[model samples]
Target: MKNHVLRPLWVAILLVIALLVARKLYVPADFGINGRNFTYGYYRKASVNDWKEFKVKYKGRQYCKECHEENFDSISKSKHRIIQCENCHGPAIDHPDNPEALEIDRSRGLCLRCHADLPYPGSHRNDLPAIDPEEHNPDKACADCHNPHKPDLEG
Candidate 1:
């Protein structure tokens, strides 16, 4: 009768509400790039708007080098000069405050973090003479072989 029909309709409405709630919680609508006409998913791009929203500055090693001429000059000679400062160390925002006071991350493990094969741009070679912890003593850091601020191969 009317009771049976109403019961099924109520259940259907509840199910629809549940699905909407689940979608809102788990599914991120704006997760992809917002294109001109449409949008993009993980790999797929929108044919309309391919350009970036805003311009980004090159706030990496080169930016740091411009300010720290003396330190930059010294590090220029090192093998690590080819590598960016943020590669081994995290970011260089606070390090400039008191260069000596800041505990610059000089761990062999940090070097191995990228050299492990993650392969970000300008990453060092795996064969580039890093000491193996299992094979060698842990007392050695990258600084042991190559001086960071004043690493002159000629010296």
Candidate 2:
């Protein structure tokens, strides 16, 4: 090739070689593909220990059910059975275990997360009941007029 093309090709080759050399020095010893059987082919082996020590925020519905059987039973029977308690109640980081009530989010925005009326043509969102947030009592919280445990019923 001519000097014009040859010069650019040589610079490109040198850049790739420099990148490989820099990666060898900068990359951690434990971060790479251990084998074909390693997690996702390429993974850091130390991440497993990191995950083990990580504190989980949201405990499952069963965790809430351990103490609040009455409320849990009500939710389980209602259409909200598909929804997790922590979805509206925030994370149950240390609920009954720490004897602290989970923070219940009574904001209209919380209900609007699923209940906002945005029904489009040929969509599955129609299954969940939709409401006009502004028209359906702008001043009051949905929980004030409707019980989430029995959401279809009025308060």
Candidate 3:
């Protein structure tokens, strides 16, 4: 009876020791670096090449201003100053090398994303003018009354 229980316990201890040895051998020597934990280091080693080879898609407002000074100037002075050009227009990745006119999104839904009236109470609601699209102008697009570049509608 004693031998039967001892045999299983010995096998289990040996199995755990084997697993520990295998893990130590398989794991990298420098598996942690620069305060980053083991998992981060492991993934970084696996994907470092991909990150190094990656090209930037968004070149930022300064890059856009290089060719589009007039529009950039207009946007800088307007209520929409905080909004990025690429937010309305899609990514300008290839525009610099192979120039083409970007398609503008003039949809009412796009305008309403930030301007739509929500029942929730906050100071942001007061800062941003919101209207009921259905009642404001049932069939008309927001662009009909508002200029996207300026968007103040006060002129």
Best by lDDT: 2
TM per candidate: 0.44, 0.70, 0.68
Residue pairs of candidate 1 with colliding backbone atoms: none
**Per-residue lDDT for 53-155 in model 1, tens only?**
4444335878777777777777677666777766655656556666664345877777665444443356556445544566555576766875665555357
The residue-by-residue lDDT of candidate 3 on 1-155, one tens digit each, is 56988999999999999999999999876454646666563343536667888997777889899889999999898888898888888678887676675656878889888888776767576567788877889689888878888888784
Candidate 2 clashing pairs, residues 3+ apart or interchain: none
lDDT of 1: 0.62
Regions more than 4 Å wrong, model 3 = 1-46, 98-101
The number of clashing residue pairs in each candidate reads 0, 0, 0
Best of the two (2, 3) by TM-score: 2
The prediction achieving the highest TM-score against the true structure is: 2
RMSD (Cα, Å) of model 1: 9.2
State the lDDT of candidate 2 residue by residue for 1-155, as single tens digits: 66897899999999999999999999988887777666567878888889999999888989888888998998888888899989988799977666566778889999898789987778777677998988999999887778898888742
Model 1 spans > 4 angstroms off: 1-58, 93-103, 114-126, 149-154
Please state the error at residue 51 of candidate 3 in Å. Answer: 2.2
